[model samples]
Target: MFRLFGFDVRVQSGFVVFMVLIVALYGSEFGWWLAGAIAVLTLLHELGHAFAARSAGADAEISLGFLAGYASYRPTRPISRARQAWISFAGPFVHISVSVAVLLAMGVNPLSRDSFDDSPASFAIWWAGPAIGLMNLIPVLPLDGGHIVNTALDRVLPGRADKPMIYFSIAATAGGAIWMFLNGYQGFGIFIAFLIIAQLQLLNATKPRPSPASPWELAGRALDADKPAKARRLLTAALSHPQPIPPTSNLSMTPARANELIDLLPDPYPHGDAGNEYVLANLLMMTGRFDAAAHYAAGSFDRHPNTLSATIVARAAAALGDHSTAIGWLRSGADAGTSDSGLAMTIDRAPELTGVRHHPDVIAIRRSLATPG
Candidate 1:
């Protein structure tokens, strides 16, 4: 691991192996230069992503790995879709630009070139930059272009964009691989096969599975199905599952992104709950069932009374036109063993809780949570 351009870079063993293999296969000046160009251009590609990500108020790390390099990043907050697409495009953009500049320096017109010279440096630049970069822009999974398409789909479809993109990536990669082999580009074909495998992995992650008969899982399914009654029932029925359930696979929304914590707790936050009553109540409130949500939110407070639940109940009450109930719960929440300041801030931040925000209990807790500076 090393740092470059203010970004952490980890060169994977596979990357080293790839370089050595390529050099041995060609065994000439072109081979050595090819290896060199891949290393430099791949790093530059990732750096393009890194620079753009940081400009968008994110921290990034570059990992140079097997067939490609990636820039993983975490934004201080959610990033806009346009900015995200730009970040993906930036990598390939840098590569193509460098190729163009090199062509200009060599007194070659990029458009009119019948064939690029096979001189060591020229061959390396052509192969690594324009060739690889243009390929990366292919609208398939595990490529920069694919990521651009994914970002656009996210804007148009939001949570529903995964399967479509994954399926398209799989199909396109398979077809491209077949064409590459048929047309005597076996090397490129093998690379596409690798990309197809990546798409399959993604497909598996997003694939739905039959979970054990846990109320939390059931509640989640019910929410997905838009069955509010089922959701409320499952939430109320939450008991620990008899057997441990496997963690659900993560569906990757964006490519090559890693996140870091602002603060670390002694342990990781729990991944599941028996019934997830708080979530159900919150869902109910969101779906305009304030009465049921307010009534059910008490179950969460009963099980694990905390600022989160208190805020939920108080806000639901306020939504139901019961300002007195809202105020009463807010006071009780302020007295609860959790952070008074957190409760105060919660109420203050919720637009629905405007009715209770000015209550004396809320005021006191907000003042308590406040910093002098």
Candidate 2:
């Protein structure tokens, strides 16, 4: 059990204890007033998401977490890519707005000061808000900025958002670690190392386990050789019973490139191919074909019930005005160990769906997803 915004909130044991420790040690030094101010800022950051989601006619819930706080919301209907982008950016936007407001207020006050050495309380007010805002903006998994990047990448690249996001996270984390080391911040460096290790573990776990050539890949190879009948047979097999590819000969291309090649096939399976299905669904969703995207996502899940397919299905369901369905699928995938931090972060931000949000599996999967891949 946790408390925030004068509300009793339930959070995972890990985060609940972490927040408790933070409050215990720092609460006195910062003073109750300053500590409460920090809490309010965190809540407001989440509320930014809540308000934006509400504006889109979505349902949202705000909650406290281990070290921070979040809002969970699912849109009542499919929204435009632009709208999605806005929603993704809204949390940070709120944080920044609050920071700006504080700065403006400070500027207007004759006695307002910025030096932490002078008064820890004033320093807490001045820096805590912006620091929290900036931290949320970090483009790492489970962060608001990470969501912005992932959604944008989905919009731009369609079939492959994971690789870029993972790669970017690695680079950013590594760089942060290096900066901390160089600055002689041993404690911070250790913390960053832990974060890196966590992220890496997540990356390895969520990585598509190596498998034999998927039917889609076989179909692509056949199409490349102009073997139409063989291609059709493979596509049929994929549609009928999509199994994890068995370990086989290495493909010359990266998975993303292979997926692109598969997408180029003249008579590709409409929804059975996971990669193609994801791309198609996102395209449809982007174009406001919520029903069509939902259909394709269902087909994708039927073929391969992994993180990507689950996300598509959930998003599609949300677009189709079925928040319950969306939450169900999201929770199911999370339970099945589909640890995609971006997906978990999405769930973390929407808490009104308490059954799903409070499920122990949800945080486990999310933590797994955030581990570096």
Candidate 3:
């Protein structure tokens, strides 16, 4: 891959075979010049998508493969339907535009074609130009038209657009194949029919996942698979819901095991929802990363003050030798009538707090917890 216009542009290994096949089939009619033109124009078609995607603040890459090319894009954040539509349409739009411009210039200056009036340039132009433009407009998944249709339907159906897009594509593909057969393009018609059937099979295979997975199911599956980071992400997302599903109470998971799963999350964890922040704080604390744990706990506490979050901040503070801050957090929790004996016990046994366990403030905290709420 090589960078072009701040985007990676690469041609797949199979593209060499594609060029060889094209040369073998049409080299006599259009000669080597026409073959080179097809390759260049196809690259330009993919570049159109890259250009439009970048214009919309997305990281874009262009790739040319056997028989086709595509532009891959990843936006920094969610993009609007209008921008998506533009990006999807740009490739065909550029292909057709370039073809028309070249055709028009040739028409005005007949001398431009004096060298080879009988060359296959005309045939190559039609095939690589308008033909390719029309083929990509077919409404199928992984195609530009499919993207356009899906985005447009999102505004109308909101969340249930997949079924409609699949149905419409099937109908369109069937009609297109029939028209091709009737027009004596039997070979192309059969190819289109086969493509349509494959797409339909894929739709059937993935029909069950009509929407995103539920947080509990995803989290549970992650835990089962021993992917603690993924589970942590889902749990955090669950907690962010307007009415979060209580992980401990709503799910059939044991609290001890769940906490242990949280401890398995790797260090430098990706920051996420408040609940995940609290979990990360606990993980860091367990790993003897007192400073980072205190930072995360404090941030989580600032966002959503709760008994658990307060205890984390307090425990992390105590581990870091901040006796006053640690005692103050427990005092605040007690003042709010939110003290938990489990939290006090956990803090009292923390190995990092051994140095300050006999401090005056620590003694008072122990006395205060012993006195009860």
Candidate 2, residues 1-373: lDDT per residue as tens digits? 5444433444556554654565686767665535666666776777777777777877777776656676777778876767666776788788767865775565523134534325555566655566667776777866677777788888878968867787788888888888878888776654476557756875787677754565656766887788868876665555444346432223344545454544543443444445545655555555555676677777777767766567667766776667778767776666556556647656666333344555565555555565442
Candidate 2 TM-score, true structure as reference:
0.48
lDDT of 3 by residue, 1-373 (tens): 8888888988798887878876786557574555676788888888899899888989999888876687999998788899989999999899877875775565622225452244467556756676667777776755678878898998999988877777777777778778887898886854585568766885796567554444555776887898878877665555454434333312344555555555544554445465446555665666667787777777666767666677767777877778788778766655544545755664577666676667786677667675343
Q: Is candidate 1 or candidate 2 better by TM-score?
A: 1
Candidate 2: regions farther than 4 A off:
1-16, 23-28, 31-34, 99-117, 187-198, 201-205, 208-373
What TM-score against the true fold does each predicted structure earn?
0.58, 0.48, 0.54
CA lDDT, candidate 2, residue 337:
62
Which order, best to worst by lDDT? 1, 3, 2
What is the lDDT for 346 in model 3?
46
Decreasing TM-score order of the candidates: 1, 3, 2
Residues 57-119 of candidate 1: C-alpha lDDT, one tens digit per residue:
999999998888889999998899999999999999998898778767986656654545636
| Backbone clashes, each candidate | 0, 18, 0
Return the number of clashes found in candidate 2.
18
Predict model 2's lDDT versus the native.
0.64
Which regions of candidate 1 fall more than 4 Å away from where they truly are?
108-115, 208-336, 339-373
